[model samples]
Target: MDLSVTVDDGVALLEMRRPPANHFDEVLIGGIVDAALGLDDDPRCRVIVLASEGRHFCAGADFGGGDFAADHVDAAARLYRRAVRLFEVRTPIVAAVQGTAVGGGLGLACAADFRVAEAGTRFVANFARLGFHQGFGLSVTLPELVGRQKATDMMLTARRVGGEEAYRIGLADRLAEPGRVRETARALALEIAASAPLAVRSMRATLRGDLAGRVRAALDHELAEQRVHWATRDAAEGIAASLARRSPVFTGE
Candidate 1:
């Protein structure tokens, strides 16, 4: 399994086992959604801690193969379908972002109810740098978390927001020392678990009204824009420049 789920003291820990960059594909996203859905039905699980075992939390999808959308439209649509399921889950999630969460990885982190990170942890919205539109419903989730102006700046500039700045900008809910991100996230999950499950779910649903629907709508627009951009010469140049560790010179072609 690319993911693992363990339960203790009313908290379910869902760990992504993909190492190093932890780049995700449709399969990995499906597994995560399935695990979260199953846990939501389990009475013993009241809260979930989403963590990754890797050098980076998740570096988004692997686009090093030249084909940015490897599986094309169908694959992207399926991935978004599964991702939408994550928002429908009743249990609140706390994410431990110990390392970089870039691109779609940032979307995954933002999907959670809360995030715990260290000062060195980084959050990047790198779609423009890759000459692609943001996917994984980030168009909606990003602005929802950090406001429209900040989200716009990150998306357009592809800037790296470190943990301290992330906290100040409302991206991270809690900050921890290096190596303590998971512990801090787990503590937050435990705190949530201590509450009445029914009440918590109700409150969460009320606070996050129509969020899943909004994400589903946003994915459609994002994917369409990505399709158009992926066909441009600038997109190819951007990918090549990134792989070669240089700046991309895009001509509005």
Candidate 2:
């Protein structure tokens, strides 16, 4: 649950450093919200870079590592607020995704202004596979990046998209060499960093929040959907089947 922050050349770089997969739980999610809060208030930080330090970019909530399921309801509430902050941030944001961004991690990426990843990196909405549907604002964010058809396919089928295809499909802005993801992300941030801060901030805000009311409504719908799914037998079956390496025998339960 280690989060690091650095500011240079009018850009703030925030790194997720939980090792291995950088899986985020309640505390990590709160830390993210706090970072965004700080960036919004910092005059020197014109652009913010969200990067992770690990082999895989993120694996979503750390349910197995802690009491996430016990606090799942409150966690989702906090994350919903965090998602709003991320999209409403007055500064442009860049994301460096070096590997898999599954479930909520993928949702977080969709909130970024620019997403750069390695050619081999994988992006998957995997909520269905987990028997859960807590994607925060991905219902709108993902469709905005790709399209309704592709977003539906990704979310419903729970398939993975490679970094190159993600870029071509508009889910990612650039694909870098596996070892150069950080460098490429830094370069892109520097380009934004050199721009007029006020103009850049305004443009990013407009793009991310063109329909603020609609976005919030969509978020509320998603949260409600998530609550219903999480309390269902089907979701438990999905999690059990995944953990046991067996196909889920869903009976519409």
Candidate 3:
């Protein structure tokens, strides 16, 4: 399993164990969904602090070899189903973003109710750079966090937004000192845990009305578009260029 869960002082800590970039796949995302759903029913867990034992929070899918799907199922659809489960869980989440949250990783961070990041933390929405439509429910989560204009800019330009700018743009809810991202996130989780659990759940549900359903709907379109793009020569070129650390030349293919 790529995930572990522990509870302390009404705060549940869900840690992703994949190191380096911490790219996510079906198994990893399913583990998170299962754990979060269990925690939602555990009386001891009032909030969840989502962190990772890695240089980066998550670098999204490892296209080189990462398994985004099972052999029997459609890849992106399966992964997006698990991704939707994150939005359905009742417990609020706080993500500790250390180094970078790129591609679908940015969507994962946005899944959290709050995010704690440091000045140097980089958040990139690089789907266009990769020559694909964004997945992991980013179509809904990104615009919700950073507004439609900023989200459109990020997706189209594929720019890397640092923590300070992220906070300024409402992408990051809080900023911590360097090397203290997880600790600060845990502290914020603890603070939320101090609130009345029932009331908090009620308010959260009210504020997030129809969000999970919207994400589910958005994912269907995202997956369909990605499927079309994946067959394009430009997508092949973009991916090759990215892996080779060079610029891509798209010819409207």
Candidate 4:
């Protein structure tokens, strides 16, 4: 949950330092919200670059590392509360996405204004595969980026989308080469930073238009659905199958 923030040339870089796979929880998500809110008050910061120090940008939640089933309802509620703040930020964000952004991680990427990814990068909306409902404001953000049809397909199929396809579908704004994702993301942030700050913020506000509120409502519904699914035996099997590295045999229970 180590998020480092540095500002230079009107661009604020928020780097998540969770090695290998930057998995997130309530505390980590809250830190991101806090960092973004602080950046909003800085007149010098026009753009934010969200990057991760890891092999994978973010592999969603660490289901195996923690007692996921314990007090999950409370934990999810807290996480989603912070997630809504991500959309409330005034500064534009360009996410440097390497490796995989799965489940909630995909939601995190979509929270940014733009995403830079390499050909090998994978974007996965894997909640259905886990027999769980999608969270992290994805209900609104995903469809907003790639359209409702594409978002529905991704969520329902729970398939992996390569960077090229993601870019083509508008899920990713830029496609970088291997090992250059962060550079490309920073470059994009610099380009945005060059614009008139007031004008950019105004335009972004108008374009986004109550997105944070919409995400807030969506998160509420998503969390409720997740709570219901989490109690099911299917969810148990799905989590077990994923941890065991095998395909889940789901019986509609």
- Top TM-score prediction, candidate number: 4
lDDT of each: 0.90, 0.80, 0.90, 0.91
lDDT of 3 by residue, 1-253 (tens): 5889999999999999999889888889889999999999999999999999979999987776655322212767788888899999999999999999999899899999999999999999998988888888899999989899999999999999999999999999889999999989988998999999999999999999999999999989988898888888888888778878899998879
Worst 10 residues of 1 by lDDT: 65-74
As for candidate 4, its clashing pairs are none
- TM-score on alpha carbons, each prediction: 0.96, 0.92, 0.96, 0.97
Cα error, candidate 1, residue 126 (Å): 0.4
Task: Looking at model 2, report the run of 10 residues with the lowest lDDT sum.
Answer: 62-71
The segments of candidate 1 whose C-alpha lies over 4 angstroms from its true place after superposition are 65-69
- Spell out the clash pairs found in candidate 1: none
Instruction: List model 4 lDDT by residue over 159-250, tens digit each.
Output: 99999999999999999988999999999999999989999999999999999999999999999999999889889889889989999989
TM-score of 1: 0.96
- lDDT winner among the candidates? 4
For residue 217, give model 3's deviation from the true position in Å. Answer: 0.3
Candidate 1 structure quality by residue, lDDT tens digits, 1-253: 6899999999999999889988887788889999999998999899999999978999877777422346555667777878888999889999999889999899999999999999999999988988888998898888988999999999999999999999999999999988899999989998989988999999999999999999989998998998888889988888788879899999977
List, in order, the clash count of every candidate structure. Answer: 0, 0, 0, 0
Error of 2 at 159 (Å): 0.4
